[model samples]
Each structure stands twice: as structure tokens, then as C-alpha cells.
Target: MRQEPEGYAWSRFGQPEYTNWLDESMSWKETCYIGDWSFLWQHRFTGPDALKLISDFTVNNFEVFDLYQSKHAVHTNKDGKVIHEGVLTRFGDEDFMVHGRGGFWLAYNLEKGNYDASVTNEDWFMYQVSGPNALALLQKLSGSQDLADARYMRAVTITVAGHEIFALRQGMAGEIGFELQGPSSIGAEIYQAVLEAGRDFGIRKMGGRIAMINHLEASFPTIATDYIPAIFDEDMSGYREYFLSSMPPFAKPAYINGSYDGKDISEYYRSPIELGWAKVVTTKRNDYLGAEALAAEKQSPKRVLRTLEWNGDDVLEVQRSLFEPGEHFAYMEMPRDQRGYMWADRVEVDGELVGVATSRGYSYYFRKMLSLATINVDHADVGTEVEVLWGAPGQRQKAIRAVVCPAPYKEDRSRGQLG
Candidate 1:
């Protein structure tokens, strides 16, 4: 939603960009950076039908999902387009927690069926303590020593600030990390305790403005930043009407950008395969909502998400344009897209429309202008050059040079050095 004029969690008591994001980004990799993620919406499902309801709609194989374990659950539409995705944490056979926009999708699914599952919206505050020293800082907290040995995607319950918290073995930044989730009643206390414990480890509380640098470097395609939420098709007009009536304008794709003048909103829908979620799509043992469509789509995918390393010289010139007299392009905001549009800019190869670029931002950690693009498979080869249109629609556009780079452009150390 047009969240706020600032649109970040900078309101936190700790320093936001104490010096600058360039330093914070470096600290986040070399040492540690703590980020507040309490604004992320969460859904709790508890009932005899909880597993049934969730499994019936998602493509993840629950056979591998055990208590305290989690998976990056992907839920697709009837057309195999990704409708919902989140870290699905299983507490029991019937109790579950979903943290992300997928919670809204789960709630919508509840209304469509007569399932016996009960869903609760949780207003928990989440903190991401991550980087090389993340484990060291977490080890300082009470009941959190087990985090040192926690496996990827595992959840551990810890008592901090006299409150029970779930420490999820995850991070968007792709480092050794734990996502601390607990009730809001003790949020301040927990924050204080963690801060006190982290004082010796060179921890920096990252500002909201540069929060998304991790997503770009780690290859996480977000909803608004990456693609429009696939919620507006002819088949989804009912859901669209319901969503538009209840949700804010920023949450709905149709109401937001209107970036591309194309009549079909479906063109913006990204499939699980296209979004680099191929490994999570499984059809063994149970049927999901979009089984047939996903099976068909698995045979071939047109576009795949790739990193666009914007040419250094051209990017330097774009930044220099900010002071020039007249004709300038869409301003390149650092760390993330501050303007908040989906940024459905045109991507062309030899003057032919080949793909679309989204999620343009600067990464001081990478020290390069970066963006995520869903390009045609043929043009997605690493090192292939393509042109990214660098202006808003009807503006003086410039074709900035870019090249296809490997997704997760750097090695992810999240799964390393447990214990």
C-alpha cells in the first residue's frame, strides 16, 4: 500500500544508516546487521483440517514437512501462476504458521471453502539477526544457544525477555541468520536485550531504506518489487472484486502501477518455474490446486529470473544526471526501488522486445547497479547483453546496458557453519 511516505521500518529506536548504507551493507556481510521485520504480516492456522486445507492448495510435498521444520511453500493459481508463497512452518500435524503475503492468500482460501480450519492473524514482531557474526550474537541470548546448530529452515523456541520466541533458521540476506519472532507485548524488551547482548559483536541496526539490498543480492523476487501479485485475471474477477473492496490500493496490482498499458494483467503473472522456484514444485503423494497446470508448465518455461548487472559507466552517468539541466531518466534509487512502482520497464535485445526488467536498485555491497529481470530463456544466458529502457513511460527513455548474470550472484553462506 502507499505504505508511508518513507515506507520503511526506520521508526525503530536504533540507528538507521548510522553512517551510510554502504557501510551497513558491508557490515551486514563482514560482521552483522540487525533489521526489524515486525511489519510483515503473519497467519496462524490451527484445526484438524489445517494441513488438509494448506496441502490441497500448495505444491510442496508435506511428506518432508515435519514438526519444527519448514519449507518455502509455493501456492499457485489454476494456471500454475504463483498466487501465494511464504515460509510455512509446521508446529504439528494441524498447527502451522505462515509468514508473508501468502497469509492473505490463505485467509482468502478459507473464505472460499467450508474447511474446519481456524486462522488467526498474528501481530508478532520479527527481527533478523544475520551475517558472519549472527550466531555469535544469537548465542548471547537466553535459550538461543541451540541456534548455533539449527539446520536450515528449522525452528527453535527460545525464551528471551521472559517471552517464548521462535527463531527461524532463515534470512533474506543469505547469511548465517535467525529470524526472531515473538509477541509485540515484549518487543521493546526483546529489542533492548538483543541490543545489549549484541554490543560486543559490532552489530548495526539497519535502516528500512536499505533493507531490500539483501533481496537483490540473494535473488529473492518480491511481490511489488519483482512482479505484480497474480490476482487480476478474468477467472479471478471475483477475488479481485473482493480484494479491491477490502485491501488498500498499493496491495492490489491492478490498482497500483498501471505501468504497462497492456489490457491483460495476466501478462504480469509469474509462474513458480519462472520465479526460480522449480525445486519446490512436487506432485508426489497428493494433489494440489494447480497440479495439472504445473505439470504442464514443468515441461518448459519461457522466462527465468536473472540478475541484470547494469553497466558501471552507464550507471555512473545516470547518477550524474541528477544535477544536469533538463532531460533526465527515472532516478535510480539506492538499495531498493524507493518510488514503489513495480518498475515494469522494457528489456530489448537488438531493438526487439525480449523481456521486462523489474526491481532496479543499487547495492553498495555488490558495488554495482543491479536489478532483477524475467528474461526469455534464450536471452537469459550469463554474460549476454541486453538493453534496459531507463525512463518512465512517455518520458525521454534511454537504453541502459545490462548483462545476464547468475541468479544468487554471490555464494550464499546461509547453510554454512552451523554450530
Candidate 2:
């Protein structure tokens, strides 16, 4: 008899959920939240060669990276596959900060290549205050009722809880939000102040489970969740070993989920266009690594990112199996993917494999099961019929019917909110 294999899992970045998962998820839609983001890495670069070196690797048009402004930076391999991506901010002519794994990619390149720049990882703490009431909370904490004036992706330094914080008018939930970044030493002070001040506005604390709901609702593709880190392959083995050596045991990338019938892991790598970041790639006369290849690939992308709406009845049927059946499918975790494995599920059209779905989750705001999928362009049209191969392979897998829908399943309120 085969005991169900110990299910895969991941640790939430924070202490734990303050509010329950369901309420915390609904907070983004009804009120607001303060999400602990210190788990993400921030890499800072300074010196004359910093901008040039970054430009050499980034797919974005850095011609417009002015002080106090930030751009979505994406780095791809020589083959045009995304190596890493995150927000790149310019604080001065030659001083910059990039947050997320993209920082690791930059760090790796800095060590190998000859560049006259100094790179250091900063342990700065980051907190996201988001939703309709987010600005209200910021105003209350900073006493800067005028904080609402900060434009999108622009950074403004202000004192909050008596600590200087660089507040960027950005958000993950696609709502009116601010990313408060500052010294790690005062992270606790700032976080506590905001929580107390935001009580009136109904601010909830976000946990790992509910924090990423908007990624699916707003249609943001994520690394590790959507595709494996590009650093794990043979071509990147040297860098991969070096990267893993410095990390803790729990941080390794060792899980593969879903029923992707691919023999090679590289079969899952995605290009910028396929990931819905085509606009970020700009070569226009300036050649970067993979510039020519990406320019060519964009002309005819194999697939495009989209949202798949699962059939409610079929989904319910899968859940119903849990009670009576000898072999029941895994239960759908709320707000985000559970069972690890990047939550990728194979997509098919008339039983012919077409693409793979990633970032599967349920959005209570929309009251639907949603997943970000990189589908074959041939069948990428809205309203197209397809099926999601749910559950682990050879483990009571079920085919749930689905429909092609818009990538951002909801309106992105983060675009141009004034306050």
C-alpha cells in the first residue's frame, strides 16, 4: 500500500498570519493590508560603471531611468529566457537598488565580469501598505497628508514613525499602495506604528498565503511559482552551485509540481513575450545580451500569458470527491497554490497538450479559481475552450474544463491613482 507521499510545501516569510487567511485576502478588496517584505533581497550598486553594467544586462530601456524613478527591470539569458526580474530604482546618477532575485542575478554577473562598480546586499526592510485605504494609513503615520501626491514608481523619502522611509508609489495588489523601504533596524518600529495608526481604516496584516492573491488577480507572472529559476540548468551550473552554496538549506529549488510531461526541465522556460513583459524589452539600437535574439523572437512569440477561468461545477466535483472516493484529488488551497511544485498544470485543447498553467489560486473577490497560463498563441484567443489537468500525475488526476480570459482578471487600480 502506498501512503500518500509526504506533500511538498513552503514556509511563509513572516511570523504567521495575524488575521485569518480568508479575511486577509478580502482585506485588499474591502480595506487594506501591511505585508512584510523583508524576506526579499535588495542589492545596491554604486560607481561610474553601475548604470552601464546594468544596461548591458537589462532588457528595459534604461535611457529614462532618472533619479527618484524606478523601472521594471528584466534580465534574460543569451537565449532570451528570463533569468530574473524586479523593480530597479535609481537614487543618483550612479547609485541604484534592485529588489528581488534579479539582485542575485546582478550579483552573480558583477562577480564574474569586470565592472568598475561596488555591489553590496542591503538588509533593508520593505513593507507594502495597499488597497483603497492605503494612502489614508500612510498619511496618518507620516503626518504627510500630501503623501498622496507621490506619482507612480517615484520614490519620496519621508519620516514615518520617526524613521526615514523611502516610500515608492507602487503596489503588488494593483491598488493604491506604497512600498515603505528603510533600515532594517527600524522595521519593527515602522511596522508597529502603521498597524496602530491604520486600525481606524481597517488595515489587516498579510501572510504568505493571502499576500500573493493579487498576483493572479492582477496577472503578474512570478519566478519559481511560474517557472523554474533559469540558473539550475547545465549551462548555468557553475553559477548555480555558487548561488546555492551561500544560501540556507531550506532555500534550495528542489520541487517540481504538476503533470508537465516534459522530459527536460528547460521545456518550461518562458520568454518575455510569453510572460506578458514584451513592452519592457527595448533594444532600439543599443545591443544587450540576447538583444538580437529577443528582437527576433518577439516577432513571433510561441505563446502569451493569460488567465484561465475554471469551470465551477467541475472544480466543485473535484472537491466533492474528497468525501466518498477511495482516491480523491488534492484540495484547492485558498488564495494561492498549495502542494508546492509551482502549482503548474498542463493545459490541453481537445486532449492535445497546448501549454502549461502556473500560479493557480482561488480569488474570493472574483469567487473563481484562477491561474496564470502560458498558452500556445494559436489557441490564445479569449473565449477559447481548454482543459486544466488538475492534481498530481498518476494521483487521481482530473480534467477540469476552462475558458481563456484576460490576463489581469480584474481592473488594475495601481496604474494612475492620485491618492
Instruction: Give the number of the best model, judged by lDDT.
Output: 2
TM-score of 2: 0.94
> Between which residue pairs do clashes occur in model 1?
none
Mark the 10 consecutive residues where model 1 has the least summed lDDT. Answer: 1-10
Off by over 4 Å in 1: 1-19, 244-261
Model 2 lDDT per residue over 85-195, tens place: 888999998899998878877778888889999899899888888998988778877888557788899988878877778998886887888899998999999999989
User: Best-fitting candidate, measured by TM-score?
Assistant: 2
Q: How high is the CA lDDT of each candidate model?
A: 0.77, 0.81
Q: What is the TM-score of each candidate against the true structure?
A: 0.91, 0.94
TM-score of 1: 0.91
